[model samples]
Target: MLDKTKRDWWRSVVVYQIYPKSFQDTTGSGTGDLRGIIQRLDYLAQLGIDLIWLSPVFASPQVDNGYDISDYRAIDPMFGSMEDMRELIAQGKKRGIGIMMDLVLNHSSDQHPWFLQASSSRDNPYHDYYVWRDGMPDSPPNDMQAAFGGSAWTWVPQVGQYYFHQFVPQQPDLNWENPALRREIYDMILWWMEQGVEGFRLDVIDQIAKEPDRYITSNGPRLHEFLRELSRETFQKGCLVTVGEAWGADLQRAKQYSAPDGSELSMVFQFEQMMLDQQPGKEKWDLVPLPFVKMKASFARWQQGLHGCGWNSLFLDNHDLPRIVSRWGDDGAYRVQSAKLLATMLHGMQGTPYIYQGEELGMTNVRLPIQDYQDVEIQNFYQKRLGDGYPQEEIMNSIYAKGRDNARTPMQWDDSPNAGFTVGTPWLKVNPNYTAINAQSQLADPDSVFHYYRKLIALRKQYPVFVEGDFALLEAEHPRLFVYRRAWQGEELLVVCNFGGEATPWQLTQEWEDAQVLLSNYPQHPGDLRPWEAKIFYRKNGAAGES
Candidate 1:
């Protein structure tokens, strides 16, 4: 059993993200529900994961796939009742696994009662529950564009005003400036914690601190104060872990939020690494090559800046991202090899590692035709492409390269029909590669990517260096390879990943004389890397003790 008394349980833990809608459907309703997750507790425990972060199960309109919550206190009807959630938590705890629920506090569906009341009239008690502004004559407030690609202001005919929506118009941003609204959110959070949840994964957490006037900028004077208040009241309870999704967070801001003094969150997810593929002049999802040098430099910067000052929630693929095997590595022909390489690189990093559902099984992104795209974000971009006078071929190419729905498909559990996710039709089409990339196929093969992840998690738990270690970027100038070192106490770990699709020669530095091959994506020592292969080496003496 994993030790629960560790000072930083998150550092050594491997969190598996589960998009409840796509995980499994026990009721044959073509949608995964909480009872389905309850049935899979043993499977998750067998996978050796420390925690499971379930994407929002709260009441939502399914507009943003549960990210736009309507009722924070009740479970969505489509995802089973609150009793099912309680049972899932109870069963998960018995398997030595914790549960983290997604907390979408930044915004709520327009269907939410609070939003309905806020938009009902100008003098309603909940009128200030959400951001509402009067249009100055005929122009909207500022030039802040909605992230979903339109005007951030949506005119509410009922209120004769416009409300702010960072995402879809159906979802309205909550007014965090309202003290009563803040208390209500906190009360809901505490209520869930009392119901046996171990932690929360705050969605779009950085968006909550939007400047009252500036709106888009961070570092608002009141933002830190609000976070500090939340930390003191909601997060300092010791058992409840809080991880924030803070996009565009720099190292200094990360430190202030995750300081050991417990000012804000326990850790925050940084999006700098994820934004590498975004080209200079592109608005749509454009696929650019993942430059190893830039990736190395970004990792080094965060490592140097946040060492002992803050914590990072390290991840590659999530419901919002394209599969790492497809985007970062060569997933076409070198799928298995590249998957293992990406796993080694992410798991060996000094942070709390998150493994998306089916990531351990080397699940590649689903290839969807332009007509099959269902994600609102993708649809918005496609409409933008049309409105901007872009050719249909260019829009199709962009969708093929970077659609969020590629990662939102049903989890591949086995070679059976519907990827063993449901006996009924899946909500989204399953990837055809599920026949070869299922968990059952990988579980039987000891050398599969799934087993590599198992080893990586085991190593993180076994060696303190993998968790609380200080990180040092090795000065290897090879463009095809990314290398780094982690040292803590007297142990050291050397991580080398070949980002290219060709065999590359890796020269071990003299300082790694005592290194032992701990793990590798390909068979180490005897076998050479076949493009995007990775290896982890453990040295007897730490980097500090060497030389």
Candidate 2:
């Protein structure tokens, strides 16, 4: 067993994300709840996860699912009661898994008490809790667009003013400039921590400290100052682990946020790798080539930048992203090979690894018709394309290829009805491929993707080189392979992955000749790496003759 004392708990930890609505439905109400999660603790424990980052469970109107929080202190009834959440924390503790709730501090549902009160009258006490402004006569505030599409500003008839919502109109951005509002949010956070919750996964954290300019900029003076105050007063005590959902943060800014100084956050989920498919100067939903060189360069920059300065929350797929096996790997045929390869490439790097709910089973993206799309972002894009005179086939093709809803379908738990997620109807339709790709089938197969994940996670715990070692990318002149080295103390680990579909050959460097094979996706050594084969090697200190 690894020495728990020697490791920074967070550094060696693997977090599993639970999209609450689809995890399990205890009440048979066609929705997964907190009670369902509590009941499923043993299943998660068996998966070797150290932390559970539950997506937003706070009270919401479900406009953007649960990202729009109506009340920071209350659990949504669709999920469960506050008491149910407390019980979940209690049960999760017995299983040795920490729980992190999603903190949507950047905005709140317009139905929230604060927003409701703020909008009721101009003189309401909570008027300043949200950003309210007088319209500039005919022109609106710049050309700033809402992240979910359309204008960022919405007219509030009751207050006779316009309010800013960076996302949907129903989710109004909170005014962090208001000191009282900030205190209220922090107090809520403290209350949850006191109730046995471990920490928070801050949603759209970078947007919390936006400038009046209403554009994408990082580390604004006010933003840094507020974060410093938040850390000094709240997170610096070390009982809580905070990670930020910062989309555009570069390496320098990530270092500042995650530095040991305890200023902002423990780590931030940077989106550079996730944005690999996006084209320059075009809207984000557009599909482009997934260039291996660009992907390698992005990962290398982040790995080198945070070498010793700070840390990153390493992940490939999350609720907001398309399935990794489908987007980054060849489809179901080479799924197992690519899944293991991606795991080797990511888990061997230095950072905290987060596995999305269905990633271990090698789930592919759902193929849905245009009418099946429910995500606000996808809907907005479809509308925009139609308005712009784009052909219906082009619009449908984009949605099919890159829709956010592709990742939100119900979990595939079995080959039974509704993939065993629920006995009755599911909130969203289950993927039709669930019969062949369910977890029950994979769990019984030793060579399945699920087993590979178990091995990958176990290796991280078994070897310190994977969690705390210095990472160095090997110069493999081949375009189809990704190679890197992790070294610490007297231990060294080499990871090589074939990112292509056909067989590829690689020449071992002089430094790699002394290494012995430790693990591999293939059945034999140096055989043809049939599309996405991964191999790990442990280096011997000296020549065998000397020993």
Candidate 3:
């Protein structure tokens, strides 16, 4: 039997996400591999993170950067052998860290064996494994659009039908209605759990129950039923953590998925706050200035909504998003201070905080010419917009602001060539400012962003108030400040942050007048918060269960 205490380990620990392709390269192939991650185990351990959410490393054609899996069980040769993955799991465990694999269950690469067989013949046993519909050659079943671009349906000559794909045509959606397909996916998940994987990060899991005919891609009718079955068959057998990437989940839907009843998932990745900077009813490319008031309201809603009923996953950036420092924080003069401020605001919240690779070093976005971009999403957008008669300058400007390549740049380990990520040529161009922003320099500086993150993570583990406290947003309408209070039994934590580059006037509440400073980005606390300043104050009450 799985120890209940051991299974809940994820709640209090920080998770570090590694984009394998850009983490570190050991084979001189200019691509990071499992062996490269194995070599960096000690660095992660030293940083005090308890989990590593490794992105998809399964065998693939690299069409969507491993999100399109050709084989669920095999490790891609570019990454390394299965043995290397085993070593990573074993080594991580030795350092008191867990491994969480990224599973792409919503779709599979067209090159997958099941898809090949399904598309080959109408009478094939695997035909029902994927979503297919009859359509005329000149027209698809509907006018639905794929996530990347173009039509969502592709005509297969042999089967005389169109297959549904939510992403690029190379990735065909799976049919969850098929019993056999569900059984196969369950068995594959069990196989990995048996191999000692501690958890899973489900990619686009909310889209699995999509109704292609109805043009509904998320929050479909049978989504919960399917998720409950997934839990009963695999995760429920142990204390395994499961996080679903749910872009459509609201406060109520989030409750159903992550309720303490343990029916569906441990938590969910909601994009409500992430979308605050984008134009409403438009794509991410339609950027707008960050709305501080809306952003705080969104954060307050999630924090209060999921306080006791469900859970929340706190994060500022990820592989699919641009660097937070560049997007919201000051990335130039106050880069270090702003990065630490953002971390304080996020980590002080009540959730399992996720740290994306290179975020700890205060990384910023990179600017490259359109032709130099390597991301399929970017390339597709550029072509589609150009064909639509949009100005080339306008399209390129949006790319600079929101391209995925911003976060996929190679991790800067030192000031050496290629940011010390690869001895050979890099798969993506290294950011030009790596010399001053690399990890080597940060590790030696006690007041660097890297060390600040280490302190914040340690504080989370040290205080129970951080885990079980009640969150109340302060100064909810403040233009350039994000302030909140976390209170637990007989204790309170006041977190103050200045989100702008200019000094902001602020004053502490009367109750926290004598609170001790727990952590601060600046050495001295003036009457007003300095540019991008962040501070956390701690107070203790003598009465039991006191507010």
lDDT of each: 0.83, 0.83, 0.93
lDDT of 3 by residue, 257-328 (tens): 999888999999999999988899999999999999999999999999999999899998899999999999
Q: Considering every candidate listed, which one attains the maximal TM-score? A: 3
Worst 10 residues of 3 by lDDT: 1-10
Residue-wise C-alpha lDDT for candidate 2, range 184-223, written one tens digit per residue: 9877877887887877898888888766465643455687
**Backbone Cα, N, C clashes tallied per candidate:** 0, 0, 0
Residue 458 lDDT in model 3? 91
Full ranking by lDDT = 3, 1, 2
User: What does candidate 2 score in Cα RMSD to the true structure?
Assistant: 2.7
Clashing pairs in 2: none
Evaluated at residue 159, the lDDT of candidate 3 is 85
| TM-score of each prediction | 0.96, 0.95, 0.98
Candidate 1 per-residue C-alpha lDDT over 385-494 given as tens digits, one digit per residue, 9 for 90 to 100: 79989888888777666788888888888989998899998888889998888988888999988888888988888888888778877755668878888878788889
True-structure lDDT of candidate 2: 0.83
RMSD of each: 2.1, 2.7, 1.4
List ranges where model 1 is wrong by over 4 Å.
3-7, 136-138, 215-219, 526-530, 542-547
Candidate 1, residue 45: how far the Cα is off, in Å: 1.2
Looking at model 2, residue 78 earns an lDDT score of: 95
